[model samples]
Target chain A: MNITTKLNIVPFVSVDSMMKLVLAIGIEQFLTELARYVEEDFLRWESFDKTARVASHSTEGVIELMPASDGKMYGFKYVNGHPKNMLEGLQTVTAFGVLAEVDSGYPVLLTEMTILTALRTAVTSALAAKYLAPKNARTMAIIGNGAQSEFQALAFKALLGIDRLRLYDIDSTASHKCAANLANMGFDITICASGQEAVEGAEIITTVTADKKYATILTDNMVGSGIHINAVGGDCPGKVELHRDILLRSDIFVEYPPQTRIEGEIQQLADDHPVTELWQVMAGKASGRKNSKQITLFDSVGFATEDFSALRYVYDQLPRTGFYEELDLLADPDEPRDLFGMLLRAKQAAS
Target chain B: MNITTKLNIVPFVSVDSMMKLVLAIGIEQFLTELARYVEEDFLRWESFDKTARVASHSTEGVIELMPASDGKMYGFKYVNGHPKNMLEGLQTVTAFGVLAEVDSGYPVLLTEMTILTALRTAVTSALAAKYLAPKNARTMAIIGNGAQSEFQALAFKALLGIDRLRLYDIDSTASHKCAANLANMGFDITICASGQEAVEGAEIITTVTADKKYATILTDNMVGSGIHINAVGGDCPGKVELHRDILLRSDIFVEYPPQTRIEGEIQQLADDHPVTELWQVMAGKASGRKNSKQITLFDSVGFATEDFSALRYVYDQLPRTGFYEELDLLADPDEPRDLFGMLLRAKQAAS
Candidate 1:
């Protein structure tokens, strides 16, 4: 007679449940906690095994897997960007991630990442600007207002105390949508007509456009001295936002160099070109902004470490509020060696 | 007035449910289809964007993410291994994967890879042996009889017509369980006491041990000349099965070079060691077994392409067989950009 056993499996955290988790935690509180997690991980920058995201591109869009670990826990995110998906009445992006124990390679959590990605990207931008931008930066100039615009606005408010926003979009309704969403969020707003007008007096200029081309949304002439530029949109081959002259003039700070070189604004620059890794700056090994007249550019290409930090933060915080559902994503079998036995029981249960 | 919209979300196939899916698809049919998928993808070996898996390791185990694309479609599998998991009543390995369109990067299919990983490994072994081993190879020696032993035996039978199996395990009860499962399937089996005894006169030899430490399961003296050795279990940094002499005597073939150098049996060899990729062999660009007197060593650590092929196969086969349920994993809102609206609706539903 052959004796077999079973393993325990966890439940999954679907997109709906994730949304509830955020709403339950309250977006404001979530952003504040997220800021701390990102900052903490950024500080311990050397402990992680980091890499640029591995991407597979097609004519329409790209799907990527971003993985990173801090010697103990491992995290990887599956994300896709399909700008054309909106035309088909689908999301411009969708994502999910796994948080696993490095000691055993068992996934402890599996959660939807579409909403989480938005929150993290916004939080990352806010965290970087907190250190790189001007000390009293109160107003931000946002160009290419789209799906990610509102999150950026909210994170800036939550992290940097940026109560004033100047917004511009090629599509006027996008600005209207962003302005309308922040109608009573305790922020002053200016709906500018063009990119030039939007950044005229703003202290920090954030570019989050959705074009897949080499977009010069902010030219050299428009960039003012001492204004820190958060170049967020140009994050891959053939995608960029700043004019070549802006990178030529600014003190460039990047996520991971190899990735930023291929995906961030530095893709426009040469191989031997100089740039600063954001982790190094956070680690105090490198300087951020030297003087008020110096232009500091955080060429944000969305690093795997940021996602790793973000996912870990969500995993820690969501459970505290009792807002997340436990996902049975890993199997805990009764007999460690008898995987086939699990199937036998499932078959019996079905019939 | 703001129109609130919500997408109906559901939990897709989690690791535990994949165990259920394997049973739902029927182990025999799943293996058969898996063999077909593995073969189909191998035939078109040139059409893939392949890379080494990204791994994050701790002292006890490792978690890895593997991503690949064939231009039209994309797939990624997350897998982990821990020899100590079994001591805690957990499986030594677990895996899950996502299949998506390259055009948009949105996953259309997500699956449990624990069962599928076994199936693919077995099918890959059988397929490699088909090209390298004797056409009339009838019997196979199976060492390290664990969760994957049954699949290895069956895949060889289905793909290579090996009707007889000689099985051996350090834990003899594992062999007993394997023989019991195959009692109805009709294969004459020899339950041997040792790896050497298991290999007596078998045309093909399969070594898939679970122990993470270096153990010479099959020494050069045990494996004869002209035998096709499918070394499957000697994966990761510290694990290996065959003696270095076996590799010295055999013609080595691998899935991907850089990965095999780190994880496969070839890790024993030098960095610049010459080996043929299995695809080149399968595509007839390179040779398999050069002569009847030669020993062929397939250093199988598994690859992203095999998972990509297996995932594509699962996605295509599941819908037709009605073996899976629709998972509302992604948000499908009525209005494309109104993800916030979904929250409003969920709030109403809960209230």
Candidate 2:
């Protein structure tokens, strides 16, 4: 109720404010609550207008725009992925998003989505695991201990009650950094030497290594029956984390097939390879984990609706947390047709 | 060189800053310089990537994303068109855009585009007229007197030395308002009773009425030879201003053919109807106006690269004018892999 009343002012959540809000609410509770929003949207997934993200790929990296609308409110995220950015001391991914009213076509909220994306991605993985992971699973093996590793560890702990984390990365410092960040966050952490060692006895495997090429982080021999594989890193053309044999043996559940076929782990499989829509499973139209020993792979190439849900959740929290700044992003003349007059008056006032 | 050195800080130009920058540089001079930037991009048009805008249409209005990149710098604009918004005292079109570095996929500038769009649209039209309009033409008629009317009037005067004006709108008050706004700006003005009367004795006719339907502002009979038509308002599917017969008679020129076929005045023409690309003419690869009697129509459905050029121009002005604020839009961690650590530090700092 204390938000900006000016028509031209849009509420903007900066990175600092996002961090404060997340910490204020407690990270696990934020993830748990955000998961509910994501699930609510997934339940009504058929109602959303979905399209594959428009991407501009370059030799250095790719920039993308992901847009979705539920006919009432529309949301879009501007995101970029450059695997080589790490060597330059920058994030491999950075993002921001906007939520607007469809009726008026006016933006209501703009927020930094780098942090929210990590949160939503982890929550989505854990939400899928709730249906596909073995009952009472308490251990999760995260194969890449990069920027997204700790969030995955915490989300699993918050949603699935999985507190045991086995973390591994090609860079050992990244594994140590992940363990250090999750310290006192109720996670029982282990720094593992290899992907094989990490998944030795883990019930859930989350592969989120950041590579722009087809480098298999999960070999067929590393994956076992009844293990839920969350393929997070293999999301774009020529990027894959899991071996083809591993995907062939698993029952893949995807966010959107059209996008997944091009960007998810399923990109390695044949065009006709069957995959269940996760929303159908959530809506009870399709089954998830038919048997205890069935290998369920949530081929998680993140969807725009998930970002929409995250933005909606963040917008709803603005009133309670007061964690946003009003941005003068729109030109609002006193008379809609008098935009030039507004500039002239401003010049006169300055003189 | 005085901008922020912080990696996460992006320079943001709000509406107020945009108005100030435009006024500081003088509107006509600003339009002239921006036209040069736009013309420069058009001259090297083949080197850039182009796509039809991604649009989400609702019964009430439409929201669109226009994106383009020149391999080194990428830009995109978020814009909306809601004709009914005018009845509710809102602008029919509002927009904002971002310019980013393609190498790192990092946004360098974020600015309000509603004002910039108006400037660029006017400049583009005048630039096309330079190639397509009759030499030394003076008198002009603008069919719409809404938010974009004054900008078009000034851009024509600035670029082509046109000082005589004739304006008309369905609402006479809009025309009166436009005339009053341009008062003392060195233009000989006349208010017309109808679109036909507005075009009388005018060398260039600009149709920019803001109706969402296929309402004819210019018919075949009114379009005489040796007149260049700058059609600005018929920029979406099912929204057109010129009569189909007028399109058949004119040598239509467009920004991009793939987009014009769906959203410009050319939409009324046959699929294979001959239309010249404006960039080809600017690049000297094609002819613009073959003779003085040829009827030339520039179907102006705005493009992404124009927004790119405008944003680049504004960004270059920031150092001289100091009219931007550094926004904390991206999350920067001390270690690229320690995003969670950054949050923990934020929490500690807040406490």
Candidate 3:
């Protein structure tokens, strides 16, 4: 088969390919570039067609499809969150995405997004910290030391110059694994025994617990003023991390309010609670951190625009990296209307 | 690589495989089996979670995602319709879909749906006609002789024992092609120059024109009492095939009312228009065709449950036919929480 005969093939980046690409570009640089893409998309937020994710809740977990388009390109991610998947030796969250040309509606790229989701989620948090965190803040606390903890630590180090991490988990083995992963990465890491000890003397805090309910991981007395909290885990209707009193004391910034109010930590608050849109802060229309003593909260539920940016970034890197395989995902007959003829021809070709 | 090492891989069925499967099963038998699946799901329609398709419209065309879940399995299709695409030698519509386990939230099958969409749409039409069309309906007229003409003709032949087809299209070449495709398929076929001539003596009339506007393909004067009309072409907001007077005179049956009222031929009717739900008719809770004098119209805009049934049928045939390839679309590590470690290990393995 000639290469030109397969123009309908879509480029697919598998997990191995994504890992090789990330390692080839250097993980720190990958996070930095991904953060730049997220920031750039947030800067032009109004140009996107945004909608809240369409979710299907089941007894086990939830499966969601997040779709967004910028009129030129279209992208969507299929993701599932099953907290009990870890017991079955599966990742709690796994994802895959497609990017297509809006004009032709033909897919250009399909890639594994389980790894990319972790990278983008961390980069988005770090980018928010750049605008919302206090000036000269370096020490950060991560409450859940699971699959996302190491990425968050690395992204903050790359984007916000945070070199110290205070980590805690219900399972100490997880904290040990995270600490060992970041051992030689030039961070002063301390493995704490409890969540309260992890936030001690920390300037920024990120809570990414794995439970799927409205269980409070942090009380109002634990969160102090002048600290920026990146609430990463409480991102569903009944799932939240911080206490309502803590949210009342802080100014919250979110990706899209319509979506955030449903899936972010602010779901616990009243419907009309005033929260600043993160794009407004990025566009300089709204203040991020009002003062040095102001308690700031980055309610970090993931958004579609961020995935669109990540997909766009991966598509841009495809030419340079060549780390993709083309899959025959579309049917393009010589004469488009004679699809039956194409099928009949296939039978003849096989014979 | 070992076989078990790729356990996380998904089975992908391309267009060629789908065609080979259909041919191997015999086209008529395939349609019969697919119709059985559609009818079975309709019998238990209340068990499925349904939502209206998420559509993104551009100046040229529209792309949509149709998703549905039956508590145990979930499926969605990504489809695009561009009316202007045919001018550039491209398909007016192309589609692909995924089926996943709701418990595990892992995709099991990914298949090209362009050809499958045509087959399933025809099967769905034939299934609806089973309940809605008049008894002993044999001779039928097809208004549009484009891509969907042959399938609709064959499905009716296999399901309803229709032996005669009168086909008409503005483009005579399309009608000739449709006639050519069904030459030896055991049908008494006639090529008509106009829609009025096509429906002259037919008991059932199927209007499936390709125009994306509200140009009336069938006038009120052309339709007679007791004739069952399968309105297939006018499926979007601004697209309709039958005249408003024809719809008002006909007792309409729809797949899903909330969806059909927005995209089906009934979009021209009032929001409070009384229409019978097709599933209720299949479940024997509602009447289909009351009397021979009553004109019955099946406003077939298509629905997610039909796609879900088609995908389920394809999945059941995968193991028997062995017509699929494995795609490593998921990221599964040895230790689920140590995804970063998986990346690190890949670097060492590559070296």
TM-score, structure 1 vs. true: 0.93
| Best lDDT among the predictions, by candidate number | 2
Per-residue C-alpha lDDT of model 3 across residues B118-236, encoded as one tens digit per residue: 99999989988888788999999999988788899999999999999999999998888889888888999999989999999999999988777888999989999889999998888
Instruction: Encode model 3's per-residue lDDT on A21-74: one tens digit a residue.
Output: 999999999999999999999999999999999999998899999999999999
Q: Deviation in angstroms for B263 in model 1? A: 2.4
At residue B320, candidate 1 shows an lDDT of 47
lDDT of each: 0.81, 0.94, 0.90
**TM-score versus the correct structure, for each prediction:** 0.93, 0.99, 0.98
C-alpha positional error of residue B279 in candidate 2 after TM-score superposition, expressed in Å: 0.3
Error (Å) of candidate 3 at residue B231 is 1.1
lDDT of 2 by residue, A1-351 (tens): 326779889999999999999999999999999999999999999999999999999997899999999999999999999999999998899999999999989999999999999999999999999999999999999999999988998898998999898999999999998898888877888999998999989999999999999999999999888899998999999899998999889999999999999998888999999999999999999999998789999999899999999999999999999999999999999999989999999999999
Candidate DockQ scores, in order? 0.55, 0.90, 0.73
Please give the lDDT score at residue A132 for candidate 3: 96
lDDT computed for candidate 1: 0.81
Q: Model 3 off-target regions past 4 Å? A: A1-7, B1-7
Tens-place lDDT digits, model 1, residues A116-178: 887888988888888799888899999977777778888988988998899999888878877
| Candidates 1 and 3, the one with greater lDDT | 3
